[model samples]
Target chain A: MSGILHIAGLGPGDDALVTPEVTEALAQATDVIGYIPYVARVAPRDGLTLHPSDNRVELDRATHALQLAQAGARVVVVSSGDPGVFAMASAVFEAVEREPAFESVDIRVLPGITAMLAAAARLGAPLGHDFCAINLSDNLKPWAMVEHRLRMAARADFAMAFYNPRSKSRPHQFAEALDILRAECGPDRLITFARAVTTPEEAFNTVTLGEATPEMADMRTVVIVGNSATRRVGRYVYTPRSAV
Target chain B: MSGILHIAGLGPGDDALVTPEVTEALAQATDVIGYIPYVARVAPRDGLTLHPSDNRVELDRATHALQLAQAGARVVVVSSGDPGVFAMASAVFEAVEREPAFESVDIRVLPGITAMLAAAARLGAPLGHDFCAINLSDNLKPWAMVEHRLRMAARADFAMAFYNPRSKSRPHQFAEALDILRAECGPDRLITFARAVTTPEEAFNTVTLGEATPEMADMRTVVIVGNSATRRVGRYVYTPRSAV
Candidate 1:
């Protein structure tokens, strides 16, 4: 039996936000692998094995999926948002690069509604203009690099979306990020914190850079720093199509 | 009859890519409004009126939707990709900001798979790292702003996704933009042109910055320029998770 691996995105926390393609992939999968929460999202049924791994063990998880697929298990690697964005697609490809034998494995990356887009939709179109998406987790990269990108994005007047901000292990970094934004984008620029987006526990708050506090965000939050042109229209915040 | 407006994304021409939320919005819509092509994507139904307008009249179309919604019609404004990204969501909000009488209209922006993410998934995560999305059309913004942002994104070593990169009226601008990218990112940088992504006529091609010509892209294409760490693994091009 030939095996294929599908790296699929579950799309934020909403079932309605998930694409039909991902649904079809999950339906056809004999094995599903991902973080505990993501794997738990898949319904359990006969002939399907679920493998839920711990966080930060992405490489090991990817390798396990690869091995399972090689053994003729139709595997689907699940991610909360778009698999390509700071998620499992990169990890799977990284594994393939390290293991030449897995290079020939049939792999497909499915796209989904990323957290930033979902958060942006909840708060109006804050990313309507040019924007940048940065994974603020310092696990794979340096804080200095994040700072540099934030400065450059601000200078370019691009709205910014930050993922994995203000985790319990790295709470102070988000404060530093806020400081950099205040310095580069000024205090009045709109900043949005969307926690548990598209879920039942979802909460959205919009504040200016000066009014924002690091305590307002957590690992579950996706932060959106609006461009210079972003402002409130009635109760909604949106960046205009034209440049400031 | 309370009026409402739903700005929805059709997700790059694939019916499978259209989220259930957006599909439900379309189904409940009393009137579907957008550019001729996007409106054509929505099926014609007995109660739903299709208002297909010409291109470049986003504000007028937005106004029409607002007016219809104010008249107690359930209006759905459709865009090809995510409405928040260089699409109609901002236009509708801009109209809201301009006309206070329509401020009470209940409007919700539903997210979908943006072209860049779809293209990145197809090309195996070229935007796996930090990235910027810019609309290279110079229709609303000046060419200088696009050039400046391009330089900044390159200097920050961010992967870049460009929307509306070329058109018949501004053919030379894309060539000029390519030259800027070549200068800032160096000639060896990988660039992917994904045209009509996720559609039946979809096409994808990857080339080095030095080899990419302006003619390779058109209005339908979403162009992705890889970061310094981006490279080919087998037939796929992906930006590494770790910074170099």
Candidate 2:
């Protein structure tokens, strides 16, 4: 029996961007496994088993995919955006190490459109230069570490793409985080709000740090805070021509 | 006759990654115009009028594309990798402003796989977060500006993607740039080199700043300097986990 593990990228939002490679991988898979929402993006088909669960339960899904792969089934572990960027790739690797049975399994991760690229494309290239991505979600890590990195990026004048900026349970966290960035970088910095990027309901708004104030963002929004060089041109916001 | 300008993305290196969207646009184009090399990437198709020119002559190509659009020809302005990132999109806008006759023409810039993303995918996720792209070619800019931004990115610990890092005549420039980064970001800062990524002769190598000298890179190489938080795992290098 032959077993291969394919990690597919579901793109940022729209299904149209799902590459031919991803669609081909999905078609050949005996088991399609991913975070619940990611799994739902593909159509249900015959001879395919769907394994869906919460995003936090990555280890469980990896183990399940490993088990399926080891059973001589072509298993595909899917993730929204790119599989390698904070997605199923690491968990799959971790599972491979823990389970010697899957050590030699053929694994390849197909690149997808990451949310950072999607958000940047919508905001007129706020990511034109050096930047950093930081997740404000404290569910798995400490807020102190996140804060330290944010401050460092601000001081370095790196543009920032903030993920998990806010959720209902932690609604005020983004505002507090904005305050911290404003204190370190100054209030004149540019903040861009990209909501439902690449989706039909896409909306964009750019403002100063003083105007951002948490109210402009939501859980679904990707917040991009421009560095010192970022500027407004007509309706679009972008980093000005680099002196370099 | 509706005049249309299609800015098509020729994916990084390999022609297969050229999405169906790009192929479709190319098929419909009557005038295929862009930089000489980019124009050469497409096969000699019947009924396609080709307009190719020098690298520094971007405005010239955009001007010609706009003229073709004004003449009611279906024009496809080509750019290697993505149209938006340091490519034809900006030039198209510039041409639109310079010649008001083409202002009413509908323009579309279809996204292509950027070299940064292609290189990142091949060398793990150095750009897994916010990052900046800086062109090291000093044809239109001064070296002082490049050094300043490099110093800032190094000090602030931003992941950096470098374009035109080195060439035959100006080979020592990339070395000097690396020296500044090494001084500010330590000799052990992780650096990933991607040459002709997604092409038949694709090459990937990861080394520390101490190991990266000017000789290691050339015009075709896209260099990535991982931030302070980037770490090495065996042969792969990656930034801190990005969650969105």
Candidate 3:
């Protein structure tokens, strides 16, 4: 039996944000597979098999799901935020490519509100016009690539939201990134430091890249750096293309 | 009875993207109001009133809604994308500012996906990390400020999305913006041109910014120029800082 793979997007920690389709898929899935933290977000449902694993082994989990699907299990591969946005969707595709028999497999990717958009919304739409998203983790790609993007983004003057800016092992990366940005842009570009946005523990801050050092962020943080068009109107940050 | 004010975010054209809450609110609203096109999207329910006007006359509509609310009629302020992003929410706030008596009125902003996020999702995670959105419409703001932002975003090398890039009369503005960006960044930067994204008529072309001329984009387009880190892997455009 060829099992259909449904990659579900669990919107930024809010059950209300989950679409009816995603909810229905979760309710019907024989096996729910995801990273441990993401798996914990789903409440218990009867007859559902939960396959949770650590974050370190992503491909392994995808392979396991494919194997289970090949065994005729109705499987749902879940990811926090959109599954296609740097998540399980890629892994599933990679695994599918490795096995030709999976060619006939029906794969559906249901989109979700990514953290960048969620953070941008909470921060008053600094992302209202042009923007880009860059992960600061240098685990897979070289930091050189990250720096190059940073330089290009700075030169391009796009409003930016950074994910995985800082982690335990790489504590000072955000600071370094800020330094590069400040040099390329200027000191006064409005920047927002948003953590756990839309979640109950959501916290937000406004600063300049000049003020944003590594000490101010972590893995939980999504940094928003405004373009030169961004301005400080009272306490709020807005990028006005038209004068009010 | 003080009439309720409904501020609706019509998600990026996909009817399925409309949340259950939005549908319920739209159904319940006695008077539906918005820019002409947005008002046309939701079909008239039984006993519903429709108020459609030009896109730029937001404050006027908000004022009208307030007057209707004062007259004990429920009114909705509808926008094609999220109400907050360069849309009706601010106008509602502005109208409230004009008539402080309406300050205590009940207001609800239903969240919908914005065009930027929808476009980014279609373009393959160019928005997965950090980014900015900027409008090229300069009716309210001077070209100097817009130029400043364009220069700054280029310098910062952030992923950038441009909105309201051009119209019939203002044909050359986006081209001028492109010229500015080209001079600041290089011709080799990856650019994704998305028009009518997520809609049935969605059209898209992804190429290097060097390849994108102003004629290729218009007011209907949402343009994304990738940071140096952005790469096209197969059909996907992704910028990664790590593998996992």
Candidate 4:
């Protein structure tokens, strides 16, 4: 018997942001797998077992889910935001590539409101124009590549969203990123730090590239740098639809 | 008493993909405003006035919503996908900027599953790495700017999602885009055209830049151009987490 393995996004932290498709998938799953915090969001039930793992072990978690589904345990791998955006969907796909026997497993990637969009909603459409989303963490890619990409994005005048901007270990990289942005985007360009968005702890600070500090961001923040035309309308920050 | 204005996203087209927050907003709305198709998605109920307008009248629609809210109407302006991403949120903010009197109106932007993320989920994590979303329509921006941004994104090796790829008025631009992409990213690079995503009409096609044609895309299609590291892993396309 073939069982399904669903990679689902739980949105940011709010249950109201969760899609009914994901809710239905959770209800049908026999097992839920993910990082500790994400799996913790799923309600435990009589037939469903939750497997919560730590960070940096995405491959292991994905493999476990694949193996369980292959053995007829219906599984769902949870990610905080959209599974395809630097989340579990890619990890599961990578696991499938590693083992040819896992190719036949039924896998579906369900989308959700990612942190950047959620923050953008609360901050008022900073990404209302052409934009780029870059993962600022150097754990996967080279630091130089990040710099190069940031420069390219700035030169293109694309609004930017950055994930994993500042973690304790890579704290200095975000500072360097800020320096690079100050150089490329100018001091007056808008930058917003949105933390724990859509949660009870949700907080936002909108400042210019000149006013922005590295300390404003942490691991839980999603940073948005507006394009050349982005500005404040009343209390909200948004990039106008039409280009100048 | 003050009425609230909720700018919400209805997700792609699936009722199941709509977020609970958006659903709740609709249930509380006394007036719903949006383009004809999007307004049609909302269920018509007693005491709710559905104002379906035509496209390209975004500013007018936004102004109407604001006026209604100022008059103490519980207004909900709907957009397909996330309102913050090239949608109604920016337009509303633009309207607010135009009319200083509308400033005191209570407004909130709610997030939804944007088309790119939904398409990426269905296509198996094509945007698993750093990516950009660009509006290809030259209705707002100059043609040269679009070309320049495309070149920059290609240089950055950023995966890309393009909205409003083609319409009858500007079919030639997408053809020009393909030529530029072929020159910059080369013919062998992968591109996926996903149309009417998350709906009964949803369809997908994954082709290399060499094999692609302008006819593959339309206004309804969201095109994804993979990064250099993106490749096929079994039936799915993914960019690996670890950068080489």
lDDT of 4 by residue, A1-244 (tens): 8899999999999999999999999999999999999999999999999999999999999999999999998899999989999898888988998898999999999998899999999988899999999999998889999999999999999999999998988778899999999999999999999999988999999999999999999999999999999999888899999989
Model 1 stretches with alpha carbons more than 4 Å out: none
| lDDT by residue (tens digit), candidate 1, B173-226 | 999999999999899999999999988889999999999999999999999999
Worst 10 residues of 4 chain A by lDDT: A166-175
RMSD of 1: 0.8
Candidate 4 Cα outliers beyond 4 Å, as residue runs? none
The 10 consecutive residues of candidate 1 chain B with the worst lDDT sum are: B235-244
lDDT of 1 at B144: 97
Return the candidate ranking by lDDT, descending.
1, 4, 2, 3
Off by over 4 Å in 2: A94-103, A122-126, A129-132, A144-159, A180-190, A226-244, B94-103, B129-132, B155-159, B185-187, B227-244
Error of 3 at B81 (Å): 2.9
Q: How does chain B of model 2 score on TM-score? A: 0.93
**Native-referenced DockQ of model 4:** 0.92
Clashing pairs in 4: none
The C-alpha TM-scores of every prediction are 0.99, 0.85, 0.76, 0.99
lDDT of 2 by residue, A74-149 (tens): 8888888777665677666666655666666766666776676667655555665556667678775567666766
The candidate, 2 or 4, that scores higher on TM-score is 4
Give chain A TM for each model in order: 0.99, 0.93, 0.94, 0.99
lDDT of each: 0.94, 0.74, 0.73, 0.94
lDDT of 3 by residue, A78-167 (tens): 898777566776666666556756656666666666776666655544654446677788877667767877887766566677777899
Candidate 4 lDDT at B190 equals 95
